[model samples]
Target chain A: MKVGVLHSRIRRDEKLLLNELRERDHAVHKLDVRDRSFSIDQAGDQFATLELVVDRCLSSSRSRYLTAWCERHDIPVVNSATTAATCADKVRTSLALSEAGIPTPRTEVAFSIDAALDIMDDLGYPCVLKPVVGSWGRLMARIESRNMAESLLEHKATLGHYEHKVFYLQEYIETEGEDLRIVATDGVPIAGMRRSSDHWITNAARGAEVASIEVDSELETLVANVDAAVGGGLLGIDLMETQDGYTVHEVNHSVEFNALNSVAPIDVPSAVVDWLESICLETTAVSS
Target chain B: MTDEACIVCDATVALPADVELGEIVDCLTCGSELEVTGIDPYALEEAPELEEDWGE
Candidate 1:
C-alpha cells in the first residue's frame, strides 16, 4: 500500500505513525506542507499519484486547504476535507454533535461583547469561553466572575481576527478535574486515555497526566457516536464524564496519539496503519 | 554588501530590496527553506515548524 503523509513537521507524534507504516512494508511518502507548492486547479504529480493520503498537517489552514485540493481532484484522504472543516472549527463541531442528538457541552456564540457577556451571564460563572478555531487549551478562558468575563470578552472583542469576535461560550461540565481522549478510526476506538490536571483544562499538551482507560461498552458507543456525528475518520474524541453520562466536548481531525500511545496497552500506531491498509485495499478493490 | 545570511548554511544570499517579512527564501548553498523571522537585524531562522492545535 502507498501512503502519503501530509505534514509540515515530523514531530514525535508523526514519527510514531511513520514507523508503523514502514514496519508493515507500505510505501510512505512524506509531503511537507511548508515546502510543497501546488496548483489548486491542477494537482502536482506527487500528490496525484498517492492512493491514500493521511492528513497529519500541523497547520489547520494548510490541512484544510490541502485536503480540499485533494478532495477536488479525487484523492481520498483520511478525515476528509469535510471532516477537517467541521473538526477544525469548534462552532461547526458543536452544531454537528448537537444536531446528531449527542450530548455535547451546551454552547452559545455571540458576535459582540455585550451579547457575549449576556450569554456568559446566562451560562453562569466558571463556564468556558473558547476561540472558535483553536486547540491545545490555548486562548480558552474559564470565567469565574462577571468582571473576568467582561474583561476577557472586551479583550477578545478588540482582537483583529474575525474569529476573536465570535465569543464561543459553553456550559462547563463538572468533571472530576479530568477528561477522556479516545483515538478512533472510522468510529472504532483504537486507544483511550484519561487526562487529569490540577486545573480545569486536561489536555495532554498542557501537562495533564495521562493514564490508560479501559474501553467499556458505553465509552465505545459514545466514541462511535461522536466520531460519526462529526463525520468519521481518524479522530480524537474528547469526553467529559457527567452526572448522567459522558458529554463529548470536541472531536479532532488530524488527531495526535503520541500521548495515548505512551499510556495505551494497545499499539495505537500499528492499529492505525492496519486501518489504513484496509482502507487502501477496499478502495483498490472497488476501483479495479 | 548585503548582510543577509542563510539560516541553514550560514552562507550569504542577496535579498531583494523590497523583501518583506514572512517571505520564504531558499538557501542557495544548502537548499534549506528559510523564513524571515526578523527584519531589524535582517535575521532568518529555519522556518518555524508550522503547526496548529486540535483545540485540546
Candidate 2:
C-alpha cells in the first residue's frame, strides 16, 4: 500500500512516519504543499495510486481543497476536510465540545465589537482572546484589564470589514504544572504526554518537553467523544488540569505526533498505520 | 452610479459617493441600510505582517 504525506516540510513528523512505513515495507510518497502545481493528478501519479492521504497542510483552505479532491478520487484521507474545518476554528471546536457535554473552558463568541465588549464586561477580567481561525497559540492573548479588551476589540473591528466572524473569549484557568496532550485515533486514546512547563502554552510547538503519562478511561471517553463530534479519525486533545478538573483547551486535527512518539510507551507510528490500513480496507470494500 | 432620484419617503437628499466594499453606513435618506459592495478596498493591500516568530 502507498500513502501520500502532505506538507512534508512544516510537519517534520511526516519523515518519521514515512520511515516507519518503509520499515514495515509500505511505499510512501512525501509531497510538499508549497509546490504550486502539485495537483491531485500529480499526487496520484507520484504515489502510484494512493491508499491513504495524511494531511499536514497549515492553510485550512488548501487542506480542505486537497482532502475533498482526494476523497472524490477514492482516496482515504485520515482527517477529512469537514473534520479539519471543525477543528481549525476554535469557536466551532468549543461549540462542538459544549454540545457533546464535554467539560471545556467557558467560552463566548460575538460577531460585533459592541457585543464582544458587552460579553467581556459580563464575563469579567482575565479572559483569553483567541482568533476564530488560528493555531499554535497565534493571536491568543490573555486580557486582564477592561481597557485592554476594548483596545483589542477596536483593533479587530477596524481590521475586519469583509465579514464579522465571532471572536472567542474563553475563561482562563490557572494550572500548577504542564498541560496534558492526549493523542487518540478512532475514539480510542492511544497515548498521552505530560508536558514539562516553561510557558503557559503547553503545545509541543511552544517548547514544552514531553513525558509519558497514562490516561484514565474517563479522559479517554472525553477524547473519544470530541473526536466523534469533530468527525476526525486522529485527534490531539489539549487539556488543562484546573482546580475544578481537566478541561479541554483545544483540539487539533493536523497534529504532529513526533514528540508524542518519543515519550509514548507504544509504537505511535504503527498504531497510526494500523488505523489507516483499516480505514483503507473498509473504504475499498465499500467501493468495490 | 445612477442619477435616479431618491425614492424613499422622508428621505434627506444626498449625492451618492464612490463606495468601496465592506464599508458600512446609515442611509442618509431613509436610514434603512447602506453597505458598500462590488470592490474590496483592502483586497489589493498586502496582509499586515505578523511579528510572531512561531519557532519555525
- C-alpha lDDT of all candidate models, in order: 0.83, 0.70
Q: Write the per-residue lDDT of candidate 2 for residues A68-160, one digit (tens) a residue.
A: 777666667879877877887777788788888889988988888788888888878878888777677776788888899888888877875
Error of 1 at A54 (Å): 0.7
User: Highest lDDT, which number?
Assistant: 1
Clashing pairs in 1: A58-B52, A135-B55, A136-B56
Which predicted model would earn the best TM-score? 1
Quality of model 2 by C-alpha lDDT: 0.70
For all the predictions, what are the DockQ values?
0.16, 0.01
Q: What tens-digit string does per-residue lDDT give for candidate 1 at A1-288?
A: 888988765545777888788878888897766666878788778876789999888777778888898889888788688889899899999999988889988899999899988998899988999988888888888899999998888877776487888889999887878999999999999989999999898889879999999989998998888877888889999999888898899888978798999999999999988899889999888878
